[model samples]
Target: MTDKPNESSEPTPPRTQPVVSGQAAPSPYDSPTGEIPVVKSGAGENVPRTEDELGLDPEVPGVGERTEPIANRPAEEPTEPVTPAYAFASIPPAPAAGEGGLRRRGDYRRGTLDLGLLGLRLVVGLTFLYHGLQKLAGWFHGPGLDQTRAMLEQGGWKHGELSTAMLSVAEVGGGALIVLGLATPLAAGAVLASITDAWLWKQGMAPGFQYKPVELESILVGLAATLILTGPGRLSFDRNRGWATRPMWGSVTALVLALIAAAASWIYLHGGNPFTGFFD
Candidate 1:
């Protein structure tokens, strides 16, 4: 009773505990063993292992189960190679002769000038042949031999008859020979003589060069001379036979004949006549 002391009336004091230094408070992320719990986010959260990673035999089926990785599979095999549609390639081997014999290591050339000569020959020959037919058949506006003779007389050709005959023969015979690739040099020389004579008589000295002799006949004479100097080439019939390959004496004879013809034409055109001094 000694002042059972208003125990109920006394205020309860707060309980105090001893404090330890450097000790941190426990968090919800802390584990019982003091290790932090790892919570991965995004694609890395629930990735699976493959058969090779799990040490399973790849050859055995169903013996070991594994979650297959989507990216771990091998890529699809590529399709076989194919030739293009526009390609002109052939599978069969080309013929041996088609290659023009076996080319030596240093002998092959990517381009050639010989083909140009062949092309020229073909074009000129065909043109002359067509011209000959025009004269023969009167297909175009070309004059016949008789009318050509009259024109030659008007041009002061004293022997107009003979000149006309020779021109007709050269045009028809030489053109045919050229087209056939036979006696190419002779045919070219004949055509050259006729054309040269025509230029000198009709076009060269004419007033104002009305017919354009220097422009047109110069190119014609050059082409004809080129053909005369160079043989028709390997693709021609002359090469197939041994006849066209004549001795140097043949060329010398042709040269002499050409000089004489040219001199005769000059005398007829400008010098009146070689034998007579009177002008036409």
Candidate 2:
């Protein structure tokens, strides 16, 4: 019968059908699309897989809950990085200060700026008050009304009596108002005009920063201008009456009015022209 088949080459046995209660089980479902369904372990579906079984680290660095293979997992939409719950335990960061780290509210209160303005007001206001008293009644070792009148006439004041009286009233009344912080704008304007008028008289046709030593008129003018710009502090009558903290427009108007009054007073006293005295 020719060469006989070797024992090692004997025919392999075929797979037998699995039986369930004496009936044959059906074959696995074969979809037209050929997609394979998920498989589970034989121990049970609810049981968790340990690290030994999965061959992965027990404490992976950036991993969260729901341990599944990345390839098998469904893709998720991207979102912003989430802060952990424990991150809240740390203190929150502080906010940065604005605008060159300055806190210039410029309010009419007893704060840093208010106190400074108060001090300045007292100094200038009291000084002017003393001068006013001196011109009015010869107090503070200054010339009296008669001498003031004589000085006015000598300084080219045509209507000496009228000019002298106006200056006296302006100084005395404006000084009082400034000291009390009442009608601050009005007080500042009046005082500023009076200082400018005196400046003209004192210069007496001199030109440009000539006389040194004290420079009383220049100092008074600066102080009065500051008041016009800064307004009275919270400690003044104006603050109490809601007239303090006037805007920039108000300050500009006050300065303009003061200059106009000063020019008028100068022309009235000089009779001819106050401009001529300012130049050579």
Best by lDDT: 2
Residue pairs in clash, model 2? none
Index of the highest-TM-score prediction: 2
Query: For model 1, what is the C-alpha lDDT against the true structure?
Result: 0.63
Over the stretch 109-135, how does candidate 2's per-residue lDDT look in tens digits?
335766777777787778778888898
> What lDDT does each candidate get?
0.63, 0.76
Task: Assess candidate 2 and give its lDDT.
Answer: 0.76
Error of 1 at 108 (Å): 9.9
Tens-place lDDT per residue, model 1, 238-280, is 8654323332556556545664676676676444432222232
